[model samples]
Target: MASFLALLPRSLTTFLYAVAALLRFYGNIDTTPISKIPLTILQWSFITFILGTAALLANLGLEWNAGNRSRNREIEERNRADQERQRAVSRARIQNRFFLLQTRHQLTPSPETRTALADFLSFLQEYGE
Candidate 1:
């Protein structure tokens, strides 16, 4: 029952197409077969139209999904690049702080300044990883 309902729209569409084809091509005198089998122009048109429309729609869906996947991949790459830039900026700040501490220690020769420089260096190492 669920599956039948799922196919209801397609079945209804096919029925409507059949009705339209019958109305348009009713009382045709050319009943000649296009091939070995007895197939009229109206019948061929109906068959081709149905199959062609299905194929075209399927192709369009595939192309749409492919385009979305490509767009998502580009966004992910941009995010990664932004994160790398942020990390580079943070490392530069740490290096600057370490240099300032080193300069102060050189001038005053204090244990506190030395400890601070060591701490900044350790932080830079951790952040780089």
Candidate 2:
């Protein structure tokens, strides 16, 4: 099937050429031709090639721009996810600190306990600094 399909165009081309030759022979066509026709056809072919190249370049440019936009969107999404994770971590740390302070206050509930809590907080602050 592939071979037959491949031969089809060659057969068609030969048949058309034979038909054109026969017609031209029978019609007794003049040998004279316009000189500008070939040049015009050549110029038109060149223009067509240029237009095709321009269209291909434009398509490539559009594809490249679309790829860049997709990449940028992915980067932005990753950055957003990272920022959300950082915020979650910060919130967890703050909650942990709050719970720890509450527990310490509950464990020690007298004037001496207050002084102890102040001293502990100061120690923590100094250590942190």
Report clash pairs, candidate 1.
none
Measured with C-alpha atoms, the lDDT of residue 4 in candidate 2 is 75
lDDT winner: 1
Worst 10 residues of 2 by lDDT: 38-47
Residue 12 in candidate 1, Cα distance off native in Å: 25
Candidate 2: stretches off by over 4 Å: 1-39, 109-129
Candidate 2 lDDT over residue span 1-129, tens digit each: 966754554455455445445545544443443275543333444444455555556556666876999999999999999999999999999999999998887687798778887999999999977
> Against the correct fold, how does model 2 do in TM-score?
0.55
Clashes of 2: 0
**TM-score, one value per model:** 0.55, 0.55
